[model samples]
Target: MKLYYHPLSGHSHRARLFLNLIGAQHELVEVDLMAGAHKKPEFLALNPFGQVPVLDDNGTVVTDSNAILVYVAKKLKLTDWLPDDPVASAAVQKWLSVAAGQIAYGPAAARLITVFGAGFKPEEVITRAHAVLAVIEAQLSGGSFMVAASPTVADVALYSYIARAPEGNVDLQAYPNVRAWLARIEALPGFVEFRKTPVGLAA
Candidate 1:
């Protein structure tokens, strides 16, 4: 299996984190986004969306970071992260949604725009991103991890962007719980850090 990804992409980070957590072995292929490599015909054939984090498990092309997490955790969790209860399962699903929706669109996207030149309205981006931070802070205030008593695909899915959120200029001064949760994930074994610096934080 070969994972095609850019170092700076949050979605890509999610897929990478899950692979690392489960100790899955595969080839790591770096995609050069800045050179318009993702737009090329060959890579587009791998992922029609022209996005990062395309996992080629032999012939199976798995796109979307959250979907990759589901595939992997299903194979490996054994209740380690993804529990057995339906309601708790639903909660785990919700966190995955938050990762793809709120986390991707807000802090992750905002950082891309501010740092990578996405050109979205900067103030609007930061404002929305901060709103997500606020909500995550509240969710985590009650538990060590989001949506479960222990780490799940939820933590791996959301970890990279939130951990790197400070580089994107979203304030974390009031998000103590979220910060603590991040620290816990960071402490986990087999955790792989995202390879690139976030966009604006580049010096």
Candidate 2:
């Protein structure tokens, strides 16, 4: 399997984290987003959206970070990573949605402003980050993991951006539960650190 990704991308890190956790045999192919490599013709052929973190599992191409997580979990028959139970599955999907929506526009977007000079409003995105973090901190108050008693795709989906929220100037210090939760995920076997940016409060 080959993973086309940018090291600093949280979306790329999410997919890469799951692949590592599952002990999947894969090769990393760096896409030079700095050089606009992702926007080139050949790369766009792999994903019309021209994004990093596209997975090529023997020609079975999967794009989008969340979709890639689901695909790899299903392919490996890792029921624990993504349960088949209707309730569990729905719960996981809920957080995955959060990852795509709030997390993306919030912490991830804020980081884009600082790290990549993106045009999003910092105040707006940071507010959104805290709002989403509040919900997650509350949800994790009585549980060790997100959906189930153990780690799920939902956890993987949310982990990267949240862990690196500080890089976006979204402080993690206010939410102790969220901080603890990040620590727990870090202690998990096969866990990989998302490359940190030198900007933001955490830095």
Q: CA lDDT, every prediction?
A: 0.82, 0.94
| Candidate 1 segments whose C-alpha is farther than 4 A from its true place | 196-203
The model with the greatest lDDT is 2
Residue 110: error of model 2 in Å?
A: 0.7
RMSD of each: 1.8, 0.7
> Per-residue alpha-carbon lDDT of model 1 for 1-203, expressed as tens digits?
78998887888888988788778897889999999999999999999999989989879888988888887677665576777789888988888898888887888877777668787786887788899888888888788988777798888888888877766777776788988888898888988887656455443
- Give per-residue lDDT, candidate 1, residue 55: 89
Provide the lowest-lDDT 10-residue window in model 1: 194-203
Across 1-203, the per-residue lDDT of candidate 2 in tens digits comes to 99999999999999999999888999999999999999999999999999989999999999999999999889888999999999999999999999999999999999999899999999999999999999999999989999888999999999999999998999998898888889989999999899988899867
Q: Number of clashes in every candidate structure? A: 2, 0
**Cα lDDT over the full model 1:** 0.82
